[model samples]
Target: MDFSDLGKLKDLMGNAKLMQEQMEHRLSETVVEATSGGGIVTVRMNGRKEVLRLRISPTAMGSTGSDLELLEDLITAAVNEAGRRADEAMKSSMQGMMGGLDLPGLT
Candidate 1:
């Protein structure tokens, strides 16, 4: 309401914007890899939970129905693991950045 409070709010908004930009940069830079079925399926994902790369070993591929089902499951598991790791990485990177901001509804 007061001029001083308004000025402080402006500064807080600026800081929040800067932090969001930094987090976006970090997200693009952060890469997480995960494997399933003893590395038969490998997944590389970014902090945004986007899959960057996927690799399935030759031995893991087959023509049979059961083999295909197993492969699908393995891929699913690997992608999920990669996404989980990405979330962890983002949290770890942003840990100390939000310490004192205390932005209402954001913290």
Candidate 2:
């Protein structure tokens, strides 16, 4: 390739690296929350997909054995939803960084 083309490629690579670093920082800072079972279970997560906190309503905890299984299900649903939200947040941030540039083979 021509020198100009090589220089442009290098610059693109550098920008990509910077974007990646910025994304990492943003993911660490961004937070998302999800709830399940009429908000009996709540989960908080960051864009990095790390769970920050989980909260269960006392009413969700019943003395019945079946209640334990329901509680487990609610917790699982809340956590999964939180993770999904985190993924979406990260994807949106990445798209913003890309700034509408249509890269081949990349969403």
Candidate 3:
């Protein structure tokens, strides 16, 4: 609209970009690990939705002649647990960034 309004909009956009960049940086620095199947499998993920590491316990692999389906299930369960932890980590980071404002659907 007016010059002042245009300036305000530009400032708002810049602030939003800065905030997003800070959030992304913080998220990248956050890491979370989750395990399942009695800690037989572990997964590490960063807040940026990146998988950093995966670990399988010896006991989990010691199942010789075991059902293939069972192993698959265990792996799936472990990965799902890791994903859950990742989501929680993301929420926590966002909450802190937003000053405890849990904005619905922002994620």
Q: Write the candidate numbers in order of decreasing TM-score.
A: 1, 2, 3
Error of 2 at 62 (Å): 1.2
lDDT per residue for candidate 2 within 1-107, as digits (tens), equals: 99999999999899889988998899999999999999999999999889999999989978899999999999999999999999888877777888887877544
lDDT of candidate 1 at residue 79, scale 0 to 100: 99
lDDT of 1 by residue, 28-92 (tens): 98999999999999999999999999999999978899999999999999999999999889877
Whole-structure CA lDDT of model 2: 0.91
Residue 90 error for model 1, in Å? Answer: 0.8
Q: Ranking under lDDT, best-scoring first? A: 1, 2, 3
Q: Which 10-residue span in candidate 1 carries the lowest summed lDDT?
A: 98-107
Query: Residue 30 deviation, candidate 3, in Å?
Result: 1.4
> Candidate 3's C-alpha lDDT?
0.78
Which candidate, 1 or 2, has the higher lDDT?
A: 1
Give one digit per residue, the lDDT tens place, for model 3 in 1-107.
99999999999899889989998887888888887778877878887767788887776665466745666777777777777887887877777777866678865
